[model samples]
Target: MPRMKVLLISLAFVAIIGSLGAALYFMMKDSGDKPKSSHMARALAFRVGFSILLFVCILVAWKLGYLRPTGIPLQG
Candidate 1:
């Protein structure tokens, strides 16, 4: 990959993590011990955002060559 492309990809990954973290924080903060709907939404938002962050982290690691994937497959 070119230097410019790598830089752009890294920036994009960082942005994804930042935006998801902010959203999760706000969602949890806004939820109070009142409505069940709010609580559910908050929980869902946090989980989804967290998952996105994990994916972004993996992408970043792969881009920087810090993550190596093996061909081993595991069955659940």
Candidate 2:
């Protein structure tokens, strides 16, 4: 289960990064006298939406006991 969760989250991150890369590519490709393009904006919007969905999924998983938070130990 933990492995599945990790895989799913990793895939989501990859998709998010891919969307970001697409946005950057479109931005650079459309940078010459064509009015601002919508492709970049759409890609960015997809990235934002995907990010929110990922966050919500993680939150729900934690609430349903499929995930737990872990990090560096507190010095206190």
Q: What is the C-alpha lDDT profile of model 2 across 13-53, one tens digit per residue?
A: 99999999998988888457554467889999999999999
Clashes of 1: 0
Candidate 1 residue spans exceeding 4 A from truth: 1-34, 72-76
Model 2 clash pairs are none
Task: State candidate 1's TM-score.
Answer: 0.48
Q: Look at candidate 2 and tell me the lDDT of residue 9.
A: 98
Best by TM-score: 2
The count of backbone overlaps in candidate 2 is 0
C-alpha lDDT of residue 45 in model 2: 97
Measured with C-alpha atoms, the lDDT of residue 57 in candidate 1 is: 73
Off-target runs (Cα >4 Å) in candidate 2 are 30-36, 72-76
